[model samples]
Every structure is written in structure tokens, then in C-alpha cells.
Target: MRTINRTDFLSGLVVAALGAAGLVEALRMPRFEARGADPFTVPGLTPGLLSAVLCVLGIVLLLRGMSGRNLTEGAQPSITQWTRASAIRTLFTIVMVLVYGTLLFGRMPFFYATALFVFVFTVGAELIDTERRLPAWKLLIGGCLLAGGAAYAIDFVFTDLFLVRLPG
Candidate 1:
């Protein structure tokens, strides 16, 4: 039986690792202060801020786990009892995210890449859901709209509002 503390500890470690990695990558983004660009307008600014927050939250969780603060909550599902379906879903999401980050983001125009990723991820997730009630047609239509809308919004906000030049 795994206690909540143990689960939190493991989750926190993973979150912290991801956050730290993101922060490192964000830091590597070009800073145009040399060209008189505002520090807040740097491409890395938002990502760095978000990553730092994630890392701090993860550290807090790790500390709580280390202190066994949730021991009183008792045992939860054991590793052996973890559902195969759940594991597959988790792994699928992770792989999709990794592919989007490493392959898609910088390889294409931001709007197209983001739309593609969002569409594929939404459709794939819906298809994989055993209890999903939405039909394939609905999923397709919804995914398309969602992808387009989200991509447009993100692009508008970053490019127009934030003045961030998204990579092609």
C-alpha cells in the first residue's frame, strides 16, 4: 500500500524535474537587451516565470511529503493495483506533449503547429476514452474548432498583446 505522502513525494519530484528543465530551456532563449529590447518583452520571460512557479510549488509538495504530513490519510492504491488503462493514458499524454514540444513547436508556424497539436491531442484523447460518449464526427468538429480557436487566441495574445515573436 502506498501512502499519499509517498505518491506526493514522487509526483513532486517529477514536477520539479520538469519545471527545472523548462526553466533551463527558457533561460537559453535569446534576450535582446543587447538590441535595447525591454527585459519584460524577452521571449523567455513568461516561460521562465511559469517554470519558476512550478518549481516552487513542486518543492513545497516535496517538503510536505518528506515531512509525512499526509500520513494520517492512510494507504491508497498500491502500485500493483494501478490500472493498465490509466497508465497507458498517462504515457500517451506525456508522449504527445513531448512530441509537441520537441518536434512541433519550433518546426512550424506557431499558429499551425499549435492548432495541429491541439487537434491531434484532443481527438486522440477522446478516442482513447472508453467511456466517451461523443461520436467521431463530433470529436472531429470539436477538435477542429478548439484547435483553431486556441491557436488563434494564443497567437493573438503573444504576438499582438505581449509582442512576443513566436518561432516559426
Candidate 2:
């Protein structure tokens, strides 16, 4: 029987706790009955669900690891490392969204704030990575164009079609 790594077990437990916290916060939102508005809607519901599923899976993995079931027995160390990086990136992205939400409430224009976030985050991510450093020009141009386009589209849809006010 293979021994479960302590690191994996603790990581799983941490994720589960975070998921529970998020679920609680999401549930606390007041339901809305406004015409043409889905007040009970949570924007990150899908990702939240996915996070919950992942938490469950992580718990299972931790248990299996404890029970001497080696799920990653044949996996390469590099692959595992990359998986960890991906998880960290996901967490950071969530943090960025939360920051965006806070800024939106402060009367900042959503598009401008979001675009700035994209540019900062993309560049920061590239700078920190140890492998395959992206060219500065590529990162700058790509991030700006993509963020700008997305922000414009979202603003247009909300203002024109939904008749909703966005942070400005």
C-alpha cells in the first residue's frame, strides 16, 4: 500500500474549507423580484459549483492518499507541479474578480477597471513564471486588446440591451 502524502491531505482540506465559505456567502445573497432582473443570480455560480466538486474530489483524493491508494503513482513530478501552478492561478483569478467587484461598488467604470486588472495580472503572471517567458510586447498588446474588447462588449450589452446601469 502506498502512503498518502501529508501535503496532499492538507491541501484538500484547505480547498474544502474555502469552498464551504464561498457557498455560505453565495447563499446569503438576497433574492430579487425586480422585473427582467434575476436578483438571485450569482455570477460565479458555475465556477463555484466546479470548485465545490473539486473540493469533494480533493477530499476523496486525500482519503485515498491516506488509505494507501496511490492515484498519482505513475504521474510525472513536472505534471504535478504544473497542476499546482494551475490551481494557484485559478485562486488568484478569483481574488482579482473580488477586487474588481469591490472597485465597481466604488463608482469606478467597470470596463476601465477590468481592463486595467487584465493588463496588470497578465504581465505579472508572465514576469513571475520561470519557464517560457512571454515577450513583453506580446503580453502588452494582447492583454490590452483582449481586455478592451471584452470590456466594451460587456458595457454595450448591459447598457443597450439590458437597460442596466454599470459602474462608471
Candidate 3:
């Protein structure tokens, strides 16, 4: 009786796949060991947990789609919109992520790489959307603050709490 949105159903499936892949990769990471490592302090702590969360959320989305529930309007973009999104914004984001993870993270100091990645990605994302038309200065400052704060938090969590030395 109810019409299930094909877009949500498909997107849900895609997200679920990505989550599953992340979970598998996380599982392959080194486990907690005897070198002052607690059960919760494994190298895979964050990634593993994050992947599990993603897997759960993706499953929820899949269920929502299958049940013919009204998924968020924004969740299902029009074909033209989707094309534009994928072509520009989404691709840029993917490239940024790859660059940060592969080229920056371990190569440079942790703080520098983290800050650069966050700031550039945030500012680029904001600026790309011509609709919002946010000022450059605001984007820069906000991006800087957000990147700095987030970088600091990540560093503190890894170094102080997890005792993981993110490559400096």
C-alpha cells in the first residue's frame, strides 16, 4: 500500500556497504596488546567504534526505506541535484579526504596535518555552495577555529587518553 522511496532504499544500501567495509577494515587493525594497552585502549578503538556506529545507522536507514517510511526530504535529492552534488561538492570532499589520509596525516606533524585538512575541507565545502553566499572572512575564521579545536581534541584523545602516538 505504501510506496517506498527507491532513492532512500538505494542510498541506504550504499551507506550500509560503506559501513560494512569500514567495519572490516577496522577489525583488521592491530588489537589491544600487552604493552601497557588496556582492553579499551586498542589502536582500533576509535575507528572500530565509529564503523560500528555507522553500520547501525545505515541499517536503520535501510529499515526505514524498506518500511516505506517518509525519509527526510533532503535524503533524496533529485537526479539533477544529485549529479551536480556528485560532480563538484562530493568529489571535492572525497579528494580532500584521500589527500588528508594518504598524503598528510602521517607525513606531517599531527597537529599541522589535522588542522590543514579540517580547515581546507571546511572552508572549501562552505565556499562551494554558492547558495549560502557566506563571506570569505567568516568562512576562514570559522574554519580555523573549528579545525583548531577539533585537531586539539583529536590529539588529546589519541595522545593523552589512548596513549596512541599519531605520527608526528
**Model 1 TM-score, 2 decimals:** 0.56
- The residue-by-residue lDDT of candidate 1 on 98-163, one tens digit each, is 999999999999999999999999999888899999989999999999999999999999999999
For each candidate in turn, give its C-alpha RMSD to the true structure in angstroms: 10.4, 10.4, 10.7
Scored by TM-score, the top model is 1
lDDT of each: 0.88, 0.69, 0.84
| Winning model by lDDT | 1
**Candidate 2: regions farther than 4 A off:** 1-84, 87-91, 104-107, 131-133
Residue-wise C-alpha lDDT for candidate 2, range 19-128, written one tens digit per residue? 77766665555445454556436455665676677768777766755775444656523334556668777777788778766764346777788677777777767665
Determine which window of 10 residues in candidate 3 has minimal summed lDDT: 76-85
